[model samples]
Target: MSQGDERGYGDNDPGGRSDDAYSTLGGTRQTRTRMPRGTDDGEGYGRRPARNSRSLVMIVGVVVLLIAAIAFANQGGGDASGDAGEKKPDAAGAGPTAATGTKPVEGKNGTIASGFAHDQQGAQSAAANYAVALGSAEMFDKAKRDAILSATHDPAVVATLQTDMEKAYSAGFLKAVGLNEDGSTPTGLTFVSRTIPVGTKVTAEGVDSATVEVWCTGVVGMAGDGSTKPVTATWFTITEKLKWSGGDWKIESSSQAQGPTPVTGDNRASTADEIAGAVEGYGGFTYAR
Candidate 1:
């Protein structure tokens, strides 16, 4: 995996960075491998003499010694039991506890707006959650959509998005998904447009802004009888250029494209009733890194 350095600035909302636009959203491709069969090994290989048992033993002994030396060094300037020579039982075994407690402040980025810090992990988590929020069914409804846009987007972009989305979720689009003009349930059906993020990464980070990419999988369809389009999943990526604003992370600009998607599964499709029931039964999570 590629890694990069990240930094945070004091409470000041830096504007978006320049390299926000993506030339191509898709990632590099990897070559597929085939496993070797058991019979493919050289015929005479099994007859080779068992090699260097003594050398293996010596290597294991050295490794054990190295571990012991590290433990001893970690105990330095303190009791052998490791608590700065403290006699209390609870304090005697508290070295690891103290070390864990002293762990650095790894604040999350994007989440800082949601009360997270602007750290690498935080940035990734925020990207993932924001992707889910932006792709959710709520985005289809006027009120819920407005709430999400207001919460997650830069104030400047929300107005334009609101206008664009109003047209995008028009009556024709709703009808295509078996929903009413207003993006509501049609009688006995449950309209579902849920986005589940699979993974996230901080492609780049600046002092006051960051570029985050989220790989998301989602199901967008209606769950009801006579619906030709049953619940189906699609994979997509959302890349957001975020800036620190109003004590939180906000999307300065963002874009999305269809996946890095994998082939669809061959499992038997669930019944509409089953799908509706499952949707009602399950609850989604508030994700964090």
Candidate 2:
């Protein structure tokens, strides 16, 4: 698929950043795990004032955007919460972004969640979980990738996706992204690629089919002891066409778009070591209602 094509963006999208692009989501945010530009004594305002200038510019820009956003929020009543006159994401139990305390599915197809309810919330949950799997570090491996496709995609799409995904994550492609032919990182480096779903919405729903859009933030690339390619995060939305097949929601097709990206914050970027430690220490969430 081409950059803005209907199907999806694969090797054609930039540097083939997404290993599982064939049946998976896309991302474009890139906050690398590296240090800021150095400020040396020999270099003052005369050295390179660009960093300082950019910082100040970003500060002003954010302040203005913040003011405008607050005003807009005030005008828009509490939304999605179904709180009569309110219109905010955090309104109440009806908040689309907030968990509704619904009983989570008790089934699992391998490590991926399965056996979702036959409703809108179920579809949303399936889409969100699938997004995480498709954007995960596990997708780098052929076997794990296949398992994910088998578990999440419609059976009709499984075979073709397996082939397309193989091409998308070819050996050369893996090497280009700082991974071995087998998709393993160098001795001391950690390869990071994980998606965190922020929210889900059912755009189109029916008796047996639903289209869900999952907003996600993902980190990818290599981080660790002497890695030049530090891990970076990207924001993207994945639109999945799902069908209630075989007693559960199965993804029929999926496409990704750049973002609903927010403004970059002033928070300092973490170092490669810190990032590696965090990824190693933290585990992913299994099921969410």
Candidate 3:
């Protein structure tokens, strides 16, 4: 559309061939009159000639039915395979990008997703979820961190994790990150710490154990107009050695390292309030492979 003439109708129409222009159809040059709406075919009030009304209705009906039939055919024509005659992939899933059709675990241990299936796919899902819980801002709070560890970790490792995390989130560390000693944000600033899993891979699996790697991206720091600790995104991968304990996959041990990060894009970053609002408003999902 050209500027100031976007609507090509009425007053804003970009003028094309005028009505008096000679026609080129059938190798003839006959001048024709273009009648205004409601006056075509000598009929008034936006109507066509009564004699041709049946033909017009039939034409329109045929067009509509043809369109409908074509749409119906197209709806069932999606086959992500080599040829129309080839057998399609399984309904559950196929290929790297396909949805597995596997339902996520329905249980939650405290606020974290739990009770994953005893399979490779289930281990991947658990690793992703455990990464989110472990990277959350709640880990800076003593009680909530304990709850999170107990929910996500193996029974033998919860106490050890609790002790390590307590030292990791010391009062001095909280002050350095512009958070209060209790993990709460100061008067007006919002503390943001959230991890989102980008992808998960099951490296090894056994009858009752698995090792899954979750590639994650996260934002952490204070979000306020002029806060010193503006939120920043970090990329990392967490390798979790999981055990199928008590009908669910639990984190026996986990370690994180620098990422398989991608090159940065040129998109403009959002402001503090926008980031904070997004962090608070967005709800996470229960993932399944």
Candidate 4:
């Protein structure tokens, strides 16, 4: 979809990301047998055992030392848990991966978390977490969507975005997504809209403004017996342009693109009921950098 004309919900065209939107604006073994080397051949010439005493003694000593070494190792006094060449990856060196020690936003503008740090790391964190909120199941609800937009976005864009989202999540769009006109799932089914961030990186940064891209994998659809819209997963990246406003980072605008995707997996897909249960049972995380 063209970024220019696609507002959040309008982006949910039948072929677009929200078709699945929860009204959220879219081995082999070889064995070898060795034959005995023909009995050291006739070259031994049936000679009487004229053993080399020195070599015999050396071999005996080496065997004895090997046995002793094995015994000593088995005694468990040394650090034999790992090989000398083995190394563990350092957690800190894993790059800007996963949540660091930094705490998540403590305050909430209603259900949406707020009060992110104002630095680069903080901006990335805010954007990542906000991406989760924007793509959540809650966004299908008007009030909750408004709260999320207000909490995470630049104040300047909130009103316009609200209007855009309402138009985007039209009644037809909701019905197409297995949702009622009010954006709730039909009885006996649960609508799932979840975005799980794989990682976040700041593509650009400034003191008060930064652009962060959150790579995400999400599940969207209705889950239950006889549900036509069984939940399915997709990959996409949300690029949030944020500004330091109200003492924290807030999204000025955001857009999404299809993916920095991976090859498909071979695992069997779950049944509709199984997916619905899983969606209900699993709780989401609040992302941090």
Candidate 5:
């Protein structure tokens, strides 16, 4: 007999001979046979299980990779957060800059004042403004110079700095910047010796003292009519040793060095008239941390 007819019936075995053959092997006489529920011989049954397992594995792997990527992104791509993130104000004895709620006082001396926290920012601001005040044209004037010295310097250093500054701003130095021997304002020209602090930093801090470095750029020239070199800007760094005195930080000792400067710009220089007007119109800032 043919395999289909032998396994099931005489002629009309339409359910397929495979089902009949499976039933016959098990000694079943029934025309209909029950297939094994989880056999590998069915269409796509064997491959589909493995495929599903692989698909699940891939999905799990992708999820793990996404989690790892997000973690990496939060760490700023592994770059370190430096002094910027670490800065914090002092707890007790906080200064005006630290509180910000406290009003700022008119600086004790010239434009350079100090009521900053005894922390990094305060130390830096004090150093920078002190450098500006010390390097200013006002330091060449006798009365204003004395006032600045008295206000910002230690009592012991004031006298010494006064004498040293007098010699430093001598006749030859005045002549170089087109100023009179007594550091008077020249006719039709404004003497410029303004130091603008670029940034401030504290190298070291102690209970009674601190070491600060001030990065600064300054203009020192005679501006206006008949000026040879109208106004020239130069970059410098000032290192200050400061002491906490009666209610303020004062300069005990200080020194200066030139640049970290860059090459000159190609921009056209402003006319002496424009420069003078700009200088007069603009007011200086009361710098704080």
Candidate 6:
């Protein structure tokens, strides 16, 4: 979704009030309080207290440490012998951006895609594609959910994750999201729960294991004629710890954090009907690195 529109994760109010301020996927809000200004009654700086000797010493010590740290950093490990064999990342590729145009996985395991190369780039591609599958509406169905778990997660984590997901996507959650207990939307409505990865980064890596973080934007809600839960977007980052298993990268564990969100855009939001039409018209993709 474009900026300036309400960037959020919940249903919209038909009254045109943006309830979009609330995060739908269980997010916490933090508030910062500024220190109040001191009295300005023109006291004319009457009391000039002497600075504490301990505080001054502490400040000097901190400055010394800062200078030392900067000097050490500039030396890049302060070693005479450099690691000439190590590859340095370009400044451009070192930041958040799209894929490096690496080819996607070549195989599919059941409905889920597979056969990713056994490398850091493959780990990123697997994580991106797995994020899409795990965040899809199909995950609400038991059969599809099982298939997804089998395809993405390490065998050791699959059972535990299945139990956890069954609890997380309970009847109460389903109802709140405007889905039936069976995880189906109303006959005329379409349930939207799609994640689009904006970028991926390898956090930690080893010969056979890697941790990849996928920054994502997603939409979730029910779209229909009179639906209160109109589709709305959210921003989050999912970190997947992957293992090279049987010649393919598989997720060992995954966790999600709130966002690297931008300020909301000014675009006008569409109605429920329009949202439904758009969801039906546009199809999702299989993400790759």
User: What TM-score goes with each of the models?
Assistant: 0.60, 0.69, 0.66, 0.67, 0.61, 0.66
| Index of the highest-TM-score prediction | 2
**What's the candidate order when arranged by decreasing TM-score?**
2, 4, 6, 3, 5, 1
Per-residue accuracy of model 2 over 230-258 as CA lDDT, tens digit each? 55555666777678999999987665556
Instruction: Kindly report which residue pairs in candidate 2 clash with one another.
Output: 77-86, 77-87, 78-86, 78-87, 78-88, 79-87, 79-88
For each candidate in the order shown, give its overall lDDT on alpha carbons.
0.48, 0.58, 0.53, 0.54, 0.48, 0.54
- Which residue pairs clash within candidate 3? 38-46
Best by lDDT: 2
What lDDT tens digits, residue by residue, belong to model 6 across residues 63-151? Answer: 22222222222222221112233332222434433435556556888766698878766766787788778667787676777788778
Give the Å shift of residue 171 in candidate 2: 1.1
- Model 5, residue 92: C-alpha shift (Å): 24
Pairs in clash, predicted candidate 1 = 108-117, 108-122, 109-117, 109-122, 111-116, 112-116, 113-248
**Candidate achieving higher TM-score, 1 or 3:** 3
In candidate 5, what residue range of length 10 has the lowest lDDT sum? 21-30
The candidates, ranked best first by lDDT, are: 2, 6, 4, 3, 5, 1
Stretches > 4 Å off in candidate 2: 1-101
How big is the positional error of residue 95 in model 6, measured in Å on the Cα after superposition?
A: 6.6
* Candidate 6 stretches greater than 4 Å from native: 1-102
Total clashes in model 5, counting residue pairs 3 or more apart in sequence or in different chains: 0
lDDT (tens digit, per residue) of candidate 3 on 1-289: 0000000001111122111110000101111112234522221112111223432332222222222322232232232122223332223322254556677677888888787877767777787788778667776678987898788877876675566456545676566556777767898888776666677765555677776666665665566787665555545555666778878888765444455455655455667777777777566666666
